[model samples]
Target: MVIRLAIVFVLTFVSCQEENDIAAKNILGIGRMQAVAVSGRLICNGRPATNVKLKLYENEILFDRLMEESRTDSNGQFRVSGSKREISRIDPKLNIYHKCNYNGLCYKKFTIKIPKDYINNGREADRTYDIGTLNLANQYPGQSTDCIN
Candidate 1:
């Protein structure tokens, strides 16, 4: 009887702790907007990689939140800026989806982690990170096939 009672008490405490953790996370995710910006050029085999899709996301534990998206212009240049409201510091990352060498049905995807120093505390980004020119024909680390961006 004592063991059963202790188990019940432990479960109850654990449940309450879980609820409090969830509440804290919800509160932290609700406000305190932060912003970031990124720009880069994509090249494929010495040519401009136009119309390549680029997205900036706030990397999270459960799921990443999309902040902004854009496509490479005629000159293979893209600029994306976005903001998210969260009390905790934001983890900004950029995703590139393109088909340069692979002839598969889905596009090749790669990720670039933005440094924390570039994240601003307001809605507008103070500075933009230039990733420089990338040749999509070359294989990059963590590259994968992504049908959905």
Candidate 2:
């Protein structure tokens, strides 16, 4: 009877440990669900484009979901955040509405690709991506211009 009790106790202890492990993992996952920050600067006509509207969209097949929106500061800096899962999928893009002129005409709208590498793949506890400088005056020369409207 003592041997049987010892065996049962061992099994109970092991089961409890497993349950605790799973619970800990779930807690960690919940903690990671916080927003991932994205930051960058916008330069137009060789100067900071202040108050430019910037929007984050999750590119989807049927419809695009707007995740966050921000306006450039006086220094042309902006910061936005979204869930890591949403921002890391299907090639996220940034839509900028500004009056950046090109060839005597103001290109009022533009889109820029946010590289997948800029998003954390759920491997880091804290994630923030800096997309560097985006120049509205020039759309990187021969890049896809269809995003301009």
Cα lDDT, all candidates: 0.88, 0.65
lDDT of each residue in 19-135, candidate 1, tens digit only? 464466567666577899999899999999999999899897766878888999999999999988776899999999999988999999999999999999988999999999999
Q: Give the runs in model 1 whose Cα sits over 4 Å from its true position.
A: 1-30
Q: Pick the TM-score winner.
A: 1
Q: Write model 2 residue lDDT over 1-149, tens digit each, in one string.
A: 99999999877755554346436646665333223456889998789989988787767555555667889999999987654333224356777777677443443666666766566545332555787888877755333323333
Candidate 2 pairs with clashing backbones: none
Off by over 4 Å in 2: 1-35, 84-90, 102-107, 121-125, 140-149
